[model samples]
Target: MSTVSVREFSYNPSAVLARVEKGEAIQVTRHGNVIAILSPAGSPMERYAHLVAQGKIKLKPVTAAERHSMPHYEVPEDVDPVALLLAEREEDDR
Candidate 1:
């Protein structure tokens, strides 16, 4: 399962939902504490049912260790997007 901060989750809910629809489970956290868990439409085990049926997984976990953290970017609250866009457009006209 993967974890996402509330801010991150809310920032792009469609992207997160797309991942969940593809059988990826996600944990939503607030202030470092978990607040919700999002799973696929069916049972939690449904994601693996096909692999088990094909006799590939054997109902055992064999995941490799992962310790990478995703980068988080924050924009200053007072930043003006319209001004930035206008500035970029002006620069492009040069």
Candidate 2:
């Protein structure tokens, strides 16, 4: 969720559209109080389509962490820094 003052929106209309394109809901305010909610309309599928077209939606896989305790492990001392960074990036993509 996000918010913007009416004055700001009036000055920069694109900013509000950009936020909405990124799948963010926005509250437009006036006089320091909320006046309106700008959000997608129609069914869930339609809203999803609109968001995607605006390049606002992202899909990623979620994995649950092990609930029980596990033994701590250490990384190999000789591991390459570049390899470590690539591994981290791969994990993020997952």
TM-score per model over all chains:
0.47, 0.42
Task: Choose the strongest candidate by TM-score.
Answer: 1
Task: Give the range where candidate 2 is weakest over 10 consecutive residues by summed lDDT.
Answer: 58-67
Residue-wise C-alpha lDDT for candidate 2, range 1-91, written one tens digit per residue: 4668899889998978787776666667787666665765542344444454354663232345642454344558798755877887899
Over 4 Å off, model 1: 45-94
Look at candidate 1 and tell me the lDDT of residue 5. Answer: 96
Candidate 1 residue lDDT tens string, 1-94: 6889999998999999999989887767788766666778775466665554344654333344431343233447698755766877899999
* Residue 40 in candidate 1, Cα distance off native in Å: 0.2
After the best TM-score superposition of candidate 1, give how far the Cα of residue 81 lies from its true spot, in angstroms.
55
lDDT of 2: 0.63
Deviation from truth (RMSD, Å), model 1: 18.0
Collision pairs in model 1:
none
Clashing pairs in 2: none
lDDT score, residue 49, model 1? 50
